[model samples]
Target chain A: AQTIHQWPVAEIKAVGSPLSLGCTIKGKSSPNLYWYWQATGGTLQQLFYSITVGQVESVVQLNLSASRPKDDQFILSTEKLLLSHSGFYLCAWTTNSDYTFGSGTRLLVI
Target chain B: AQSVTQPDARVTVSEGASLQLRCKYSSSVTPYLFWYVQYPRQGLQLLLKYYSGDPVVQGVNGFEAEFSKSNSSFHLRKASVHWSDSAVYFCAVSYRGSALGRLHFGAGTQLIVIP
Candidate 1:
């Protein structure tokens, strides 16, 4: 069975603090990975997507960067967290058509 | 460019009543359609999908959606609702054919099942 796991289910930090969110997919190899952000009560916005290890494409600019160091691991990070960055972050993996999403990480920037 | 539209921001319905959520889409070509449900604070779960076929697809929990290319609409339906069915429903479209593609999601409709 395929499963997607996200680390640090929730986070609270200062405005300038650094942040890192991770996602991993098990039982699937070389799958496409994507990052999405959703506001408290808004629709989802695509951030970045990776087709393979060491290659990622940015769909939008939100002052965030993503990396796929391993085939099944994706990391989203930033040097400074802004108040506007507080929301729900989700990771998704897809190959053919159907996309499966991770549980998500809730971040609150104080 | 592809986009999805879900007109209703929120819907309130009584338990045991039939449900309908409307969706409209715009794409240059035929796309893969899907319905997903999200709990209060959880990831999205696929309710059903429409690739290319009978125009009506059945999903889990007795949920179904009809696809109409002429109207560019995909409407979700349920025979009866339960209190546990209260959640946010989203309609998405993808244009990838045997390849990698990003999903375009609608604003989403919040379903409130009143007991």
Candidate 2:
């Protein structure tokens, strides 16, 4: 069984502030990692995905960037936050036969 | 681009009653479809999935879904509903062979079970 961990359950950021959200996976080998954003009343959209270490592809960029620094560690970051950057951010990983998601971080940018 | 649609934003059902929630999807190939449940203020949990073979798949908690290729739909059904079954259910699809097998999720339908 694999587990995904995400930190800072909720966040409130001001405009132009830096942001970082982290996710770590357990019990997997070279798994595919993903980042998803769920905006208010909006569907879940794939933000990024990484197949291996040090490689990530952005599906939809909303001034946000993702990095897979290690095999089990994936991070979502932003240099500056905009009001539109607020939403529920989810970190997920896929094993050969299953998919699992972290608790998610809810960001509210004022 | 693969997409999924969960038509019912909200559905209310009585406990011990059978329940069904509709989900429609768009994909070029036979996409990997999934059903996930989200409790209030909680992250999403995978309830079941469909890869290939059987059109009808059984899932956790007495829940099952049938894939209708002609209808492009995967509707979840439960024999008996419980109050704990109330949650937001999301339908998702993913490309099978892509390196980036990203799961495209639906807007999600909130199911409310009344006792």
Candidate 3:
């Protein structure tokens, strides 16, 4: 069975602080990875997606970037945080039909 | 561009009652449709999917959704609601054939099951 793991279940950061979120997928290789964000009461927005290692595509520009350094690793990061950046971040991977999502990371920016 | 719309922002139902959540989509081609459930502070879980063939698809927890090509709608239904069914439900659409294609999501409908 495949499993996804995300780091730092939750975080609270001040504005202007740097942030990084990581996801690792096991039992699958060369899977399509995606990053999604959702505000407290807003729709889920696709942030970025990667089909292979070292290549990523931006779906929506939220001033954030993603890197797929390895076959099973995906990272989302930003140099500085903004008040609007606070939300729930989700990591997902898809091979064919449906996507499998990780537990997710909750971020709060003050 | 492909898009999904979940009309009801919130819905309340008594436990053991029949329930339905509406969804609509706009796309140039026959797109893939899905319904996902998100527990509080958790990731979205696939409830059901519609690709081809049958218009009605069954999913986990006795949930099912029927696809209507003429109406451009895919609505989720459950025979009996439970208190544990309370959660936010999302409707999504994917146009591309490959897995790399991104899914467009709806604003989501919050389901509240009352005892």
Candidate 4:
């Protein structure tokens, strides 16, 4: 069985502070990773995706960047957080038609 | 460009009643269709997916959806509803061969089952 683990399930941060969210996939090797964001009552938006290590594609620019440092690890970070950046961030990986998502990280920027 | 539309933003149904959530899509070619359910404070879980063959596909929890190329729609249905079936349902679409292509999601329908 494959599992995706995301860190810091919930976070409360001051505006302009740096933020970093991490996700690690276990039992899957070289799987395609993706990042998605959803507002409190908005639709899910694809942020970024990576097919292999060290290469990532930006789908929607939200002042954020993603990196696949290792085959099993993907990181989403920003030098400074904005008030609008606060939302639910999800990490997912797909080997075929279906995608498996992480538990998600709820961010609140105060 | 591929996009999905879930008409009903919210739906309320009584337990044991039949349920149907409508979904439509816009694509140049046959797209990969998927239905996902998101429980509160949880990640999206795949309920079912359609690529080819059998227009009607069965999914987990007795949920099923029918794909219609003529209507460009894939509507989810359940013969009987349960209180536990309440959640946000999303309709997504992607190109056939581009598994890595980002999935275009609908705004989602919030289903509230009355017990």
Clashes of 3: 0
Per-candidate DockQ vs. reference: 0.74, 0.78, 0.81, 0.81
TM-score, prediction 2: 0.95
TM-score of 3: 0.98
Q: Write the per-residue lDDT of candidate 4 for residues B27-61, one digit (tens) a residue.
A: 87989999999999888999999989999999999
Candidate 2, residue A93: Cα displacement in angstroms equals 0.8
Q: For residues B1-115, write the lDDT of model 1, one tens digit per residue.
A: 7899999999999999999999999987878999999999998899999999899999999999999999999999999999999999999998856344788889999999999
TM-score of 1: 0.98
- Clash pairs, candidate 1, are none
**Where in model 2 is the C-alpha error above 4 Å?**
none
For residues B12-77, write the lDDT of model 2, one tens digit per residue.
Answer: 999999999999998768888899998877888988999999999999999999999999999999
Q: Which ten residues in a row have the lowest lDDT in candidate 4 chain A?
A: A92-101
In angstroms, the error of model 3 at A44 is: 0.7
What does the interface RMSD come to for each candidate? 1.1, 1.2, 1.0, 1.1
Chain B vs. true chain B: TM-score per candidate: 0.96, 0.96, 0.95, 0.96
The sequence of per-residue lDDT tens digits that candidate 4 reaches over residues A17-72 is 99999999999999999999999877899999999999999989999999999999
Query: Model 4 compared with the native: what TM-score?
Result: 0.97
lDDT of 3 by residue, B39-68 (tens): 998888999999999999999999999999
Model 3 sits at an interface RMSD, in angstroms, of: 1.0
Q: What is the C-alpha local distance difference test score of each model?
A: 0.93, 0.90, 0.93, 0.94
